[model samples]
Every structure is written in structure tokens, then in C-alpha cells.
Target: MTTNNNTLLCWHSKRAGVEVLVEAIKCLKNRRVLINRAIVLVQTDTDSSLYLNHEFGDIGLRFITASLENPANHNEIYQRLETSVLPELKDVANLHINVSPGTPAMHAVWLILHARGHFPSGTKLWSSQFNPDTKRTSISSVDFNVNTYLAEISAISNSEGSYALYGVDPKSAARREALATLKEFAQVPKAPLLVLGERGTGKTRLIESVVGIVKQKKVVTLACGGLDSQVVDSMLFGHVKGAFTGAETQRSGLLREAEGKVLFLDEIQDLPTSVQRKLVRVLQDNHHYYRSVGSDKEETSDFELVCASNKTIKELATTLDADFFDRISMLTITIPPLRICREDLLDDWQKIWGEVNVNPSLPKHAPTSRQLNKLLESSSLAGNLRDLKKLAFITCAYMNSYSPTEALSKAICSLQAFDDIEENEGTKFSFGDLSNTTKDELDKLFKYELARAAKRQFGTWSNAGKNLQVDQKTLQKYMKNDS
Candidate 1:
């Protein structure tokens, strides 16, 4: 039999201990089967996961926490697998399933999914057995023809909505259209792509979904914000040994590493002008060849480019070079902010809160449905998804001690309190605005707004402090605690 490196998917057996999983992986390794990664479904606590990671983390062992109510029930197991396990298979290649560690019902669902055309077309199934008397572990293929079972069992319908797999609302027309555009763009290869959205709009997540749809094997990413110009150039294009003052060894940069895969550049608007000029040349070339910073030799990398920015198109045009902007705009995806898509905020809040409050035994730390609706109706979420998530975190932390409605209201008030002040409002203040606010909180807000307005008007901390007759350090302190 011929075998190659592939991703292994299996369940961790509680009865037999993770030793069974370790030995099974060892058996495959001995057979010269290069299992590059494993997705182990674990039902127990984090200790077992830690043990597995300690053992085979070099080979990329990953765990999925699947807390099943009835492990033996087919329906329950199938639903759990569909929701959690299937989403992770987006970028998987040459998938191999180990069927030895799970229950008979669990094993049956694996085969059912195979017969129902759920797994990738060429997925292989393997089983391992441990001999008690001989104390030896053996492996073999579970090579039953799924086609034979297909005649007896009806195929499952593809009833899952396109956005349903991504935890997005199917009822949202704007989101549905954006997803459709992404799906169409994923099929076209080697075109530069641009993703535009406000902060916390999940631009990276949307791109990952596209990569999964195309089944790309590798993804390399870098956030271009706040990086020095020379450092960003060397990091993207690589450098030879002794290329700079601190260089002791040669470096293979992100472009070379992302060969034949996806390269994601986040905060592209912050990339320096010099690097943008070089990158524009690389994109315009037919072969995409460029020289390293110090090397005379020219090299080539044919990787797909995906760039994201939190700025609008108009803002990006002002920040980025015109040629660079035109090249990356070959394909574009824009994520709508949460304020316009308010209907989606409910689902987003529930998901974010559920993630924050992971312990099921803890009392529910959520507002009543009516109270939540009223809170959303009154709040202005300028930070979009970020603000909604922050509200969830605040509610989860304070709801146990305070009334849920009060917790949510306080969270909204805190978020809405920090808006840019108007010129006329600087002269007049309202006591109504200070009703629920403490004196200390009001003082902090006052300092924060004053410092920001001064900085904006004067364009420097020293000038602002001199003009306001305040110490520079005190202005900086106020800005630090404004968070």
C-alpha cells in the first residue's frame, strides 16, 4: 500500500485512555505514514488535551471539545460533528480518519457521513487495534466500499445554508450578497484581493472562509501597522546574511513562505510608501520576480495576495499610493458595520457572550430578551461589532451581582459616553449627562476629551501642554486611562 502525509481525524477514548491515541499515532509513524496534523475530538477536561499537545504538538495535533449528551446516540453525535468538526475541514487536504478510538455509534456516523458524501471525495478510513497478550499495536485500512451502502441509504440533502456554516444570519440580505461575492472570487486564482471594513468587522474571518472554500493548504499573514519601513521591507521580501546592521543569518520572508498559497497583509493602509512602490512592481510583472534587499539574484513567488484595511475606499485612496491601490483593488469585499446591520447584533451578542461564559454550571449572566431589545434600541454602537462584544463581556462580568437590565444599561452608557465633542458643546455642559456618572468618572472623561482636542488642534503634546498650561505627562496619563 502507498500512503502520504495527511491530516488525521479521530476521537480520544476516555475508557482506554489517551495512551491508545498515542500508540495509534506511533504505529502510523512507524509505518512511514507522515501524519502532518491530527484533529482529536475530546469529551473530557483540558488535561487530556494538554497531554496530547505535549506529546505530538510538533506534528500539529489539535483538539476539538465535543461535549456530547449521549455519545451512543447517532442523532446527537451527528449534529455535534456537523456543527463543529466540519467547519475545521475547510483547508484540510488528504484527510485520513482513525476509527478505532470512538464508540460503535460514533464509528457508524463516520461511515454514514462518508456514504452520504459529506467527507472529501477521496478521504481514507483507517483502524488500529492493540493486542493484550502480545502488547502490540497494529494498523489497517477500513476499506469498505461506500458506494454499496449508498444504494440502501438515502443521501442527506444539502439543506445547510451557505452562511449557516459560518454562524452568520441567513435572513441578512447584505451579508448574504457579500458572502456570495466572496464565493465567486475564491474560484479565480492569482488576482489581488482587497477587504474593506471598520474595526471589529471580522475581515480576516471572511477571508479564511474564502480560502476554505477553495481548499488552499497554507496561509501566511502579517499586520502591516506600526512596523518600521526597513523592517517591513525585509520581512516581506527576505534578506541575505549580513543584509543590515543586526543581521546574523539569512531570512526567508513571508512572500517566499507563501509560495503557491495565500498571503494576507492586514492594515495595508499603514504600509509605508516605499514598500508600496516595490510591491506594485511585483504585482505588475507577469512572473512576479523581485530581488532581495541585499542580494543581486532575482527570485519569484507566485502567491495569492489578500490585503485588508479598516479604512473606507476614500480614506484608503488618501493614505495609500495610487498605483498600489489600483493593483489590490482587482477584487474587493466590503463588510458592513454593525450599526447598519442592527438585526444581526442579537445573534452576535449571544455568540460572543456564550464564548465568554463557557462554564455551563455557572448561573446565566444574560439580560431578559425584552431588556436586551430595549438596550439595543437606545445605544449607539460606533465601534460596531467590537462595541457589542465589549457589552457582552461587561454583562457577563457584572450580571451575577447586579440586575441584568442594569448591567446592560451601564455597559451601553459607558460605551456611548466617549464621542467626539462638538465645538458649541464645549461652552455648555448638561447635569443630565452626569446623572449616572460618578465625579471621578466625569473628571477622567473631562481630561481625556480635553487632551484629545488639544492634541488635534496643536498637533503635538508639547505644544498642547504649553497652550493649555498643563503638564505633558498629565495629559499622557489621562489618555492612557481613557481606555
Candidate 2:
């Protein structure tokens, strides 16, 4: 849909400054930007927005306002924006969300919109930047070059299917692809789905979202870890009253409960061989051959099966029956770890940290791109998405207690130094000036850390070497020498 008019949506935060909004519009105009629709979300107060509305009107940009009570509430903002914009996204030529004026949380929600495919394709993002050195405010378009991310926009619903990508770096191309695949499967749920990934790589989130997206009425999620074979059997296929030593009462099985709905088995690899065989029959034959403990009556239940494991389908094939592997390989979606795909993290979380506002020092000033990137690149964040989020909050906590006045730039520098030392020494180290730290020593330490990380991530040295394309022997030699 081509409109002579463009749309600009913005968030009005507590720190909304009239000058910032004015200069943003002026910059938009100076750049010959034509805008006819402007929707501003107001949360803090209306005084600045009154002037913002007037400025937008003066430029012939028809401005509208939505209210947000808490800018830091990511979920609320996400739902509100998604619900408000879906109907009109097609009609808008260029959807521009001004990032210059809202809480970081609000901005993060905006980024979520982009990450989640809520923004219509071809949308333009406008942002206001502050250059501390020059002490100037400037309006500009952010490089929202995520067209590849929008490849499956046609199959997309305005739901949170892409939520697993929430706050994730857009540069995480592989993860985005996995999200799209999951969404596609949810839309037309077919054969059994096998989600494969590293631990904490979000396999569980994908299955849960699938159930949500499909709107399954009756759902049964079973954790297949440390489960006794008999206990799992009793849990999956309800035991009769006094069915076993612990079965004091009759109960229905999860399979029976989830009939015609969804049955998500997290950590499916933990399923015992006998249990796995029974599950295979349910999927392959449309019938389950199972009896409750101390009961001969076999029961059956048909359900939409979604299984997750922190291992590859190929690796799982060795442990799982070949027939089961053949049966479930129909729809296997794998998620890559965060380290491999970390492009957009710096941009996404800088806004989130800004929104949190708990870091009083952060509210007074925005961090330079360099500071944000340094945090994103820190070796300390090896725990994937989960760890990064924790590190961000932890860093905020540290800022509040130890260095409330610390500029984000300086804080990031210290964090980098801390991680650097820890990484090199293979031990916990405190932050301090490493003035006399020699390049040779630092090099040795980095090599040791890299080798350790490589082994941890890739498992065997040979495997790591294959990925790194260095001979295993040579790689080990460098690591052993620590040079």
C-alpha cells in the first residue's frame, strides 16, 4: 500500500524534553521526510506531549496519542502496540517509531516490535541521538535493515511467536530462522515436532509458544528428567487406585488428559527406552499400548506431540531408536546458541537498560555505542540469552550500589577489564588498573581462555578444530603452550 503520507509513532517518557522532539521533527523535515500520521505514546506527563503534538501538526504530520502507565513494562507495551497497529500496518507506507524520547523499556518494546515482525515490512525507524562531545541533538533513521528477518512475514500473525527472539540481537540470523520455522509449524501444525538445541538455548520456550500460538485447549507438559520409568509410566498413563506401592488412588494419565490437544515433552531425551517405544506407537500407529501400574487395562490417547532436547537430532538418533528418529525427523527445528549469532544485542539492550531507569546514573545520560558494544562483547556473558539478561540486571545492581555516579561508558570499561582478567587467569579477579600487564602475558591468558571456551562449546578438540578449521594437534599445541 502506497500512501503519500508516512506514519511516525513515538513514546513519551518521563524524561521527554520538548527540545529533543522539536529537533527530531526538524531533522525529519530537513531530510525532506514527509509524514502525515504520527502516534505518540505518553506515559510520564502530557506537558511535553502538548508541544510535541503542536510541532508535529505544524509539520502537517497528523499526530495521535496513546497512553502507557509504566514505560518499563515490556509486556504491556508489546501487547498494546501489537493490538493497536496490526489493523493499520498495511495502510502505512513507512512506519517510523521515534526512539529518541521514550524510556529504554519503551524503546525495547519498540525493538521487540521489529524483532517480532510486528512492524510492517519497509518500515522506517527514526531515532534521536545525543553526542556528549558536541553536546548536540540530532534526528536520524536507524539502519533497520532486517528484510531478511521479514522473509516469512506472510505466515506471521501479530502474536508473540517470535517472542523467543525477544530482546535478542537481530544479527542472530539462525535463531530468527528457527522462530520463523516454529511459527510456520504452529500455523499449520502437522507431524510431531522435535526441537533441538543447546541447554538454555530456548527449546522449551519454542514448544510453549507453539502451544500458545495454536491455542491448544488441553495441554500437558511433562519433564522427562530423573523420572523413574514406572513413575513416568504412571504419570503419562494414569495408574489405577493402589496400582503400585505408591499409587494410593486412581488417576488419569497425561495422555488421556491431553487428548486431541497438545502434549509437550521437555527434555524428551530423558525418556526411557520402553517409554520411548510406547510414545512411538502413539505417533506412528495412532494408538498407545500402555497399562497403569498393577492394572491390565491398556489405555490410549492421541495428542499433538512436541518434543524438545538439548542435543542434535543426529546425536539423539544414536540414543533414540532409529525408527523413532525416522518418525520424528519430519519436523526438526534446531536453535543455535547466542554466542554464534550476536549482532543486534548491543542495540536492543541499550534501550532496555535505559528503560529500567533503576540505574539512576543511566537515566541522566545515554551510553555511547562503544560502551554498549563492549558490554555485548564481554566474555563474562557465556551463558547465552539467559546469562546476558542476568548480567545486564546484575550490572545495574552494581551500578546502584558501588558506582551510582559511574557513567555507563566507564562502567562498561571496568566490566571489560574484569572479564579480561578473569578470562586470562582462569580464576576470579577483582577490577584494577593493569598498567604493567604485559602484552605477552595477556596473549597467553587469552589463548588459554579461548581454548577452554572452544572446548566447552564444541566438546572435543577435534570437533572444535573442525569448526575453527585448525588442525586439532596444532590447536592443542597453542593452547598447551599458552602463547
Candidate 3:
């Protein structure tokens, strides 16, 4: 078949099958191709077996194999195609298309195509759409337009899917508003973002979701907890070959790799004073210097910075270098804890449990509204979403053997045991049985618990203030009045 070099027929693996086929058709339409040859690239001989043995096996197309199981051969295959086969193609006008689904192989094909300079500048790429039904299946193409494809991409990018590893229910209107605000900031133009939340409220998942949106962008995630100044410096800035005792070969630092993408530093509060100073410089100037063994070269890299911490920047501002604190504080969003968003448990539970295989035949013992309310009311989720999800899964298993009421009663009794620990651990103030306390006393107790909860959640006055739905100064007054 005659085809233009402008239209490349790139077929990704048929794992996501018809969804990818539909996407490929959409891309073909956008490229304005009248007729094109399809090149189906299979990751394995087994994968190729499926298509070769399929009913529609007579489609006029070439098949290429690019499996990663054997690295040496894959490299040879890549070179041969890049240097030989691709150059020898009869129709350079045939648009290079990638119809791979699911596997990293699809992305690899796209990168290879880009490296070969086959497509014109600003060529939009479409990813294979996910099929929730059928296990390990294939698909056929559907008619799609460019605008429709773009809309699908946008929707997929924003919506929650199986990729959301961990999540919590947003119980209150205020908490939901806070989540919306965080999502908004994630979509904002490349700028430093600070995520302020409690330890277990799924701050990491929020960041991962943002990373998913900017899939093309490089992501460098750093966990700053328990690292001292020198370790922090070595990891972030990198060291020269022989720069330190363990240094062997010259390594590219995360900052360099994160260029034009995201550098997520988790537990930002743990960053040492000296390294914080260097981070500030990088954020402001978008460049840094690295000294290697027997060589000194200044490297320049630009990246969007996203920071997360259980502590508030304000509390750590005095302890951290002032310049670093000021630079990152410009953009901050607080993530609310599970206790505040108790109402969201059922929905979150359904989304989570639906994806994983959890003994489908076990029994239909889903939590009732009354049961959910009782679960929320009786227990304090000290670990927030992380704790809640774990508890839910446990409750699911626990309920299979026992009745819902019996399972729930056992769970509540176990949780109440922790109250004894809380009492003996310290005189930590709690909201405590507001049912019996007077309104005035309850108000006083609520303020006390809120402050304490904030302190536990964020580890700093300023961040806890943000979670409390108040400004820093107002939080200070509340703290003082309680004292």
C-alpha cells in the first residue's frame, strides 16, 4: 500500500487491544491519512502468537518483535531498525503510528519514534484507553476525532482510577474543598508546590496523581526523613567520581534528571539547614554546580518543585533557612485527615475493593450507613487514610466469619483498647464523649482536641493552623487561650 512519510503506522502491543486500536484510528484521522499500513509490534512471541492465530489475521500489515526479556538482543533489534530497516522503508510519507497498549513498550516505541525525528514538531500523542472489563484481553478500533481524543485524555488525566494506590474519604464539605484546591494547584503552571497534610492522610498519593498527569515530564521523588546534611547533599547535588569514599563513577544528580519535570521532596521538614540553602538557590536560579573527581563543571537544570511534609512550613521556618522557607511557602495546600472526612468511607471503600481480588464469594457484608457512622464515631484514625483503608480491608475479612454487627462490635472494642494507651501515655487532650459534656465545656474541649490533633497531624503550628481552617495568627491566639 502507498503511504506518506507523514503517516507512520506504529502499533503498540494489543494488550489493551481494541481501546488502543480506537486510539490509533483517532490519531490516523488527526494526521489526515487517506490510507496507511499498520505495523503491529509485539513484545513477545507469545503475544505475537495471539494475533497470528486470531480470526482477523489477514489484515495487511508488518509484524515486529521487541521483547525486553533478553536485553542484549533487544538492543541489537533497536539498532538494526533505527539504522537499517527504518531507513530502507519505501514510504517515508507513511505516518509513524504507535498503537501499543498498557506496557512500557508503548512508551518506548513513542520515544524511539521521537528520537528518529519521524514526526513534525508539536505532534500530539494519544495513550491507549483502559478497559475495566475482561482479564488479559484484546480490542478493536472505534471511530474517534482529534477533539474527542484530547477530551478523553483530559478526563483520564483528572479522574481517579486504579493507579490511585491509596485514598481516603473526604468526609466534610471543607475537606472536599481542600482536596479540590490541592488538585487545582497541581494543574497550575510549573511552579514550586508545598503539600501540607497529616502523616497518614495520603499526601504521597496526591503527588503521584500529579505525576500521572505530567507523564511526559521526568519525576524525581526524594524522601528527606532521617537524612543528615551530608547524605542529603550527596543525593540531591550528586558527587564526583572519588568525591567521597564510596564514590566510584560520576553520577547525574536527581536535580539534573528532573529537568523540565517534577522534583518531589517528601518530609520536607527533615531537610537540613545547609541543604535547604542550596535548594533555595536551585529553585531561584534553576542551576547548580557539581564537582567530580579530578573535574569541576557547573550543570544547569530547571524543574518544578513539589514538597510534602507532616509539619507546617511556618513552624519549621525559624529552624530552616529563612530564604528556603520563604521560597517554598509561596504555594501551599493542606490535605485533610480521615477523621474529618468520615462520610467518604463507603465510596472510597468501593473504589478500592472493586479493583483488587478480595474473595468475591466470601459474603456480601458491605458496611451499612449506620455501621459506617458507628465506625467513624467510635474510633479515632490516628494514622488517617492509611489506617482507615487497612482497617476497612481487615473489617471486610473479619466480617466474612462473623455477622456485620458482631464484626463491628469487635472492631470498636479493639479500638477502645487504644484509648487506655492514650490515657496512660500522657494527658493528651481529646474531644472526649461530647454527648455527656455541656455545650460550653464541649466547645472548650473541641478547641483543645483540634489544637492537639493539629499538632499531631502536621507537627507544626502553622501547618496545623491551615488544617484547622484558620490563619496562623488566629491559631496562635487559640493556643494561648487554651494554655
Better of 2 and 3 by TM-score: 2
**Model 3 agreement with the true structure over 1-483: per-residue lDDT tens digits:** 224334334544454443455455554555464334455655666655554543433235556664545433545545544544443342234344443453454356445544433333333344434455743233233222333222322333324344323322244775778766775676666667888887887787667664435444555799999999877888788777888777878767777777777888998888998888777666775454443223476677777788888986667676667888888777788877666665565544444444332566644334545655655543456666555555556656667788756765565556546644763487444545667777776666566666555655554566567776787676555555453
After the best TM-score superposition of candidate 3, give how far the Cα of residue 134 lies from its true spot, in angstroms.
37
- For model 1, give the 10-residue run with minimal summed lDDT: 151-160
Give me candidate 2's TM-score against the actual structure. 0.55
Q: Could you give candidate 2's per-residue lDDT for residues 8-91 as a string of tens digits?
A: 767654454555656666667677776665565554345434654443453443334455566578876776665454444544
lDDT of each: 0.71, 0.62, 0.58
Candidate 1: give its CA RMSD in angstroms.
16.6
How high is the lDDT of residue 314 in model 3? 66
TM-scores for the candidates:
0.54, 0.55, 0.54
lDDT of 3: 0.58
Pick by lDDT: 2 or 3, better one: 2
Ranking by lDDT, best first?
Answer: 1, 2, 3
Task: Point out where model 1 deviates above 4 Å.
Answer: 1-169, 212-215, 363-368, 403-406, 417-483
Q: How displaced is residue 345 in candidate 3, in Å?
A: 3.2
